[model samples]
Target: MSRTEATGIRTVLSERLLQFAADRALQTREFERRVAALPADSPARASMGATLSAAKAWEAGLLWVAWRLQPRSRIGA
Candidate 1:
């Protein structure tokens, strides 16, 4: 996350963002590991890309949901 994102008082979904990032990273690492072990002519290359795309999409959806649930802070309360 950027400095503003981490330090903002506007982080209403910080926890969900953090978890989503962690999960995405892990999935990426696992995908890389498996892809590296696959043969050059393997038919699973397409599958690997599909799985990675799905993981990314899922993470994005979670972020969207969290954003909708985000709280707004009022000034001079």
Candidate 2:
């Protein structure tokens, strides 16, 4: 593929990955809200806490991958 085509594909993939990361962040926030709403003594709270932790981890991984995929500036450009 041409350089222009390759760059366009990378840009599209990067945008999509960033969007997915954003969506994961929003989901993690919703999980946080739910966990906060539950009573301290509730048994479901423990399960919700676990779920929240997993969600946070997933979001972090997505964010890291997205960061890695981003283009870096050249030193002398």
Tens digits of per-residue lDDT for model 2, 1-77: 89667767767777788899898788789878878987899998888888888888887887787777666557986
lDDT of each: 0.72, 0.81
Clashes of 1: 0
TM-score (C-alpha, index-matched) for candidate 2: 0.80
Candidate 1: Cα lDDT at 50: 85
Cα error, candidate 2, residue 31 (Å): 2.1
Task: In candidate 2, list every pair of residues with a backbone clash.
Answer: none
Per-residue lDDT of candidate 1, residues 14-61 (tens digit): 666767767887878787788878897889887887887888777777
Q: State which candidate has the highest TM-score.
A: 2
Q: After the best TM-score superposition of candidate 1, give how far the Cα of residue 75 lies from its true spot, in angstroms.
A: 1.3
